[model samples]
Target: MNNLLIGLVRALRHHHWLRLLGGAFMLSSVGNGLTQVVVFGQLLRWHASPSALTLAYVLATLPGFFGSFFGEKGCRRVPPLRLLILTELLGMFALILPLLGMFYHNIPAMLAVQSVAAFLAGMSYPALTLTFKQGLSAEELPAATCMETLIFSAQVLLGTGLGVLLFEVFSPLTLLSIDAVSFVAAILLLAATARHIHLRPLQEMDTPPQVAVIRWAGLSILQKRSLLLLPALAAVGSPAMALLPAIAQQIRPGDATGLALPLLFARSLGQLCGPLLLNGERLRHYAKSNRHLLMCLGIFLAAYGALPLLAAEKTTALGLIFVAHLASNVVFALGTFSVLAYFPAQSVSGASAKAWRWQTLTAALATTLAAGLAAQWGATQSLYAVSLTSLAAVALILVRYRQ
Candidate 1:
């Protein structure tokens, strides 16, 4: 524990601004959690339809569709830190709109405002994703991935803890105010550090045209079939995430909001521990020598696929299954992060940030489909569907691995 703490302090000092950027990312996540706990929970008091919640998710995420396509190119032109600060500013309105809607008792107006905020956020993701990826050098990649893992874990655990505590004492508007302040502070931090670091730009590559870039990405996916297969499978497994809220809704009517923070906390715990276990020199050497990252992925997916079956029992079984499910989820998070970090730096392109666009596009489609499927079959059926999807993806990966 002392060693880990010392490593973390050293990491922050070594990459101070990037570390700040990671903190900024966590702050943004906290703002997201605030909205989830306060605004979304408040909105649920009105018995908002699952469709409405799903629509909100879509609206917030829609920017990724276009951003994935164009964001990489834009990042090439702009400084990453500047782009991140601009993104933080856009998120500020998302914090404010809910407060205004609450004062007016205007549900539709609030949703509309939130939707716009979500879109702006979506637009920002590609740029921010690239900037975060570029923040680390090749040697620091593992620790970088670990730090990222830590930040997200902290965001989930601390954000939820903070949201629950603050919401208990204050109004939703008050929480929104806090969120807005965080974004402003994040922006201020970036602005202060903006000019200090000289970042490498994609133009330094004298890269091929856009069309050729797409072809190259496509070929990379085809050639590195094991690498591509895991993310693709992971994408299809997204329905498992959607099922959480739906199941929580069933656990106690309208308690879906209550489930978000706790589930996020559990996920965070796993993510934080995962990097610690995976980031050692031995594993890195093993991953590089054998280059069989897919084997670990297969084991993880098998456990993920089994979670639903384990959860299907009644009473005593349900509790056991739930524990199993949560444990599997943590392992999944660790496995996925580890696999993603193994991709060669040379595969990264100016138009995309180290597989970010591809992963986002794949996840977007999977989420859309999973949301629809969940709506139709309810949460349990969706889990079964996810389990089956994972099996199929796992099968494909195994075949590709053999080749």
Candidate 2:
């Protein structure tokens, strides 16, 4: 932990813009955990119908469908620093409206405000992703990426703990009011520091006739690879999550959630620890070791297939699930890092944005497929089928890992 703090301090000291950007996001992430639970709790308090809640969620995510295109355009047209500051300002307004709506007990108004904020938040992810890729020197990037994954996990952990504290100790309204203040503070900090970040990189798609054409044509070969390959492999891992409640059924019968939450907590631990495996040395080792990484990723997916057989000892099954999640995260992180590292500096942001779009699309498709398979085969056999998909992914990777 000391090392992580020291490493982040070094990264910030070396790169001036990163400190402000990272600080702003750290505040946002911290605030989001509390805000999410509070808003959800408030909607339940208002006796929001299931359909109304679902529509709110659907509306919130609508921006993500077009987020990459807008983010890439913003990168092309506006300086990333200015774009980031603008997004922060928009986010502050989004938060303030919701806070006010809570006082009026207006569920619809809160949902509207949240949807607008979600759209900006969605776009900001790619913006920051590009900023990190562009701003950090090559030497700083490896350490920074590892540190980034760890810090993000820590943010989730710490923020969740604080949210639980607030849920127990304070009113939901109080929690949201604090969330609004955090956003305001983030905006002020961004406004103060972001102006000094002057970047004038040549915009790759500036000559394009339309936004869609520009986004499509600007994708690099690596971006194409990430879009085509990674998401399918990710989907191949979906059965593990899909069958969790089912697995809980096998172990605890009627108390499915009783065991399911522990399984999730175990997986979360894997997420927390996974990125640590990709140190600077390991990354350098695998820079040309794409084939090796592909194999390991295949192996993790294959293990998920074996998950069904482990049900005799549910405790042991949880342990394997933990390892599988860890391996998946490590391989995925390294594969993505390779994509970011290998691409041209000018095109890295576009590639990263495209990857986000691919994941978003593939995740929806994969979830749909996983649900269909689960419905057909039940829990145990469905995982066997899921494992077969991983095997298929492995077959595909073996052919293309050369790239």
Candidate 3:
């Protein structure tokens, strides 16, 4: 706990602009959390099919996968900060699509809005990454990442809980309106952040395009191999999460709406605690020897998948979900830190963009597959299948490390 607090304090104190960035994310995420709950709750109430639920997850990520390509170009041509602000502004308007959808009770229209929101989010990712890379030193990166994870977890925790409460009283339209307002607040915060940081376009940096490509090309074979594992690593546990609503429904039949709050709470609490337990130093160490990290990830993921098979009780499932998310967050922290730490400052944006493409694409695919399995078989079986596939992918990566 002390370590977590110290790390967060140090990171915030070191970069004053980070507080602005963090604030922007916090407001945006809270709204996002509320919006998610409202959407899922409505779907549940309408008795949405497994395919429809899975389609929502797929749309949320698939556009982002394509947007990363454009983001890489934007990062090089325009200043990252400027690009980030623009995306936020556009996202604010995109919220209208969903609001309109909700008014008519059109699920497809509501789902379509996710694609727009996700694309804008994807477009901003490389810029967001570059903002940190430009602002903080290597020594500070781990702490910043930890702080980021904590903020995300807190938002999920607060957002989901608040969403549940608000859903009981407000209409879906009202909940979505709150989310739109959040985007406005986030844009204002980003504008403040812009005033504090002065960054050149990536193309204007010391490394020219040719030189950047050459530098990337010169990376060691092991480093290149490590990069390939990112998609698989990211896809880990995503299937289970994508199927979470379905899982809740299966576990407690008629009480999915009531049960979702605690399940989300447990997952968020686990994410909140994860960084505190692992800390930046441990994450850095794990990054250096990712084989052990992947091994641990496979174990936790398998256990998370297998638990549902053994027990039918909601309490036991919640405990397992918490434990699984805690470990998953650590793995995510390690993966993110490794990518940032591995690349040269000049190449980080491009590499991060490429990584986002594969990660989001694979995650979308995994969710789709899991959803199909759930539709055909069961949510539990789908989760187990994804977990076994993840373990096999891990085993392949481990074997490559040996060679």
Which ranges of candidate 2 are over 4 A from the true structure? 1-9, 35-63, 86-122, 147-155, 164-178, 196-200, 203-223, 226-233, 238-268, 281-322, 374-384, 387-391
C-alpha lDDT of candidate 2 relative to the true structure = 0.59
The candidate that achieves the highest TM-score relative to the unseen native structure: 3
The alpha-carbon lDDT assigned to residue 302 of candidate 2 equals 57
- RMSD (Cα, Å) for all candidates, in order, is 5.1, 5.9, 2.8
Write candidate 1's Cα lDDT for 1-403 as tens digits: 3233345566578866766666677777677667656655666666666655544544444445554445455555676677767767877865666776688876666666555554444455445544544555554444554554565456445665677677667878777777788788778777765655545554442345223143444554323542343255346444454445455555557465655445544544554554454433443343332234444434434443454455333332234333433333333333333433543222343333424445545555666666676788865566567646755765565465433
What TM-score does structure 1 among the candidates reach? Answer: 0.75
Residue pairs whose backbone atoms clash in candidate 3: none
**Residue 10 of model 2, lDDT score:** 82
Task: Write model 3 residue lDDT over 63-172, tens digit each, in one string.
Answer: 98888877878977877878878887777777777777677888887787778867876788778778877777777777767766765576567778788788889887
Evaluation by TM-score, superior candidate among 1 and 3:
3
Comparing 2 and 3 by TM-score, which wins? 3
In candidate 2, how many Å is residue 176 off? 4.1
Which lDDT tens digits does candidate 2 get at residues 188-260?
7667666656543534423332232325455555545555444654555555554554555555564443354
lDDT of each: 0.53, 0.59, 0.73
